[model samples]
Target: MVAARITVNGKETPISPAAPHTTVLDFLRERGLTGTKEGCAEGECGACSILVARPGVNKPTDWVAVNACLVPVAALDGQEVVTSEGLATAGEPGKPSTLHPVQEEMAVRGGSQCGYCTPGFVCSMAAEYYRPDRCAHADADGHTDAEHGPNGFDLHALSGNLCRCTGYRPIRDAAFAVGTPTEEDPLARRREQAPPAPAATEYTQDDSAFVRKSTLEETLRLLRERPDAVVVAGS
Candidate 1:
């Protein structure tokens, strides 16, 4: 009875009006979230990175960075997403919002240039920042390497993001400079709780339908009924 929806930056939005094939990037952009760029429609460019909460190995939820251009809006029914604009904490009326640790480091360290890829880089870096094992692994190793920072930041976390004008030194500096999340950090505290459970959705508009069954048995039954249905994994 209820329409399919997604929670973006803590706001619940209905996923209708947009077509079933609309990418997450387009959906967000249509709502004035211009930070998610589309450098390449293909997933090769990391210009459309966004944070997604998913099951984690060490913590209850992990802030996972994913390419928005590659995922359909319909596939994220009942999911929660955080764009670059959502990273900052809102200030009191008329006051400027406080930046997240990753954004602060990036600004102070000159990590942005032209500002196209900066948001994507920030999202990816934030994902690594919230990684539960990052600090523990660094402490265990007790030594920094070319690919890992002294603070346990693995440079590989940013391998997908690319910059054309700004050199990587500043970006690397920013990534290495971010400190651990404080106890008061809401995003950090979210790790203690479970990520949102997947929702079974059946959304239709303009004669096109998108469905997500609650169980494998129902899915298999639907597949048998509709032989033309295409399966999409991890959409």
Candidate 2:
């Protein structure tokens, strides 16, 4: 059986055929990319969050934060995924990589405590930091008033994430402190030139299979043929 190849953190990773049911969280951990943690496998905790690039109407690509534990490894084929480890700018071999704005802000503002939920929070916050409408709510002074600015940072973006030790105030502070990102930021460049979404593809190994349908017809056909198959949806 051929290994299922997928891109992770700018490199192509070949997944073994024996684990068709592997979750994205497991896939990353297996490769030692432990930055993405799993606090709850049910997708309620948001502790396994990671950024994913998907097709968009207004833009070439849209960045979204999703629970890695809830996503299947096969579903990642031909898709671009960025884990917490991939958020920072790559540095020279002997130098340390520069931290992403979200990471820097989180650290400067004391957003982490036990650190179990820090990785997930950082990924989710990074998604919001890169959002095109992030500054929509800023006032004339270029600052968003705490819980008052209309169109400002959406605190609800962190609704899916849970941080039992740090509480919400510090995290909220980090979110507001993210300020404007510089042009040199990798994510800033990605926002301007994200690649288009990949076409649907099917992955099969032994008796197990995973299918990503690009069109309604193909999706309907799959549902009709496999009525009892489990379906997962992402928002």
Per candidate, the number of residue pairs that clash is 0, 1
TM-score of the candidate numbered 2? 0.85
Off by over 4 Å in 2: 1-3, 136-151, 222-228, 233-235
Top lDDT prediction, candidate number: 1
lDDT by residue for model 1 (1-235), tens: 5798999998999998999888999999999999999988888779999999899899999999999999989898888899999999999999999999999999999999888999999999999999998873355557567888878899999998889885699999998888999999988998999998888888888978888899999999999999998887875
Position 176, candidate 2: lDDT: 72
Model 1 lDDT on a 0 to 1 scale = 0.91
- Show the colliding residue pairs in model 2: 137-151
TM-scores, each model vs. reference: 0.95, 0.85
Compared with the true structure, all predictions reach lDDT values of 0.91, 0.79
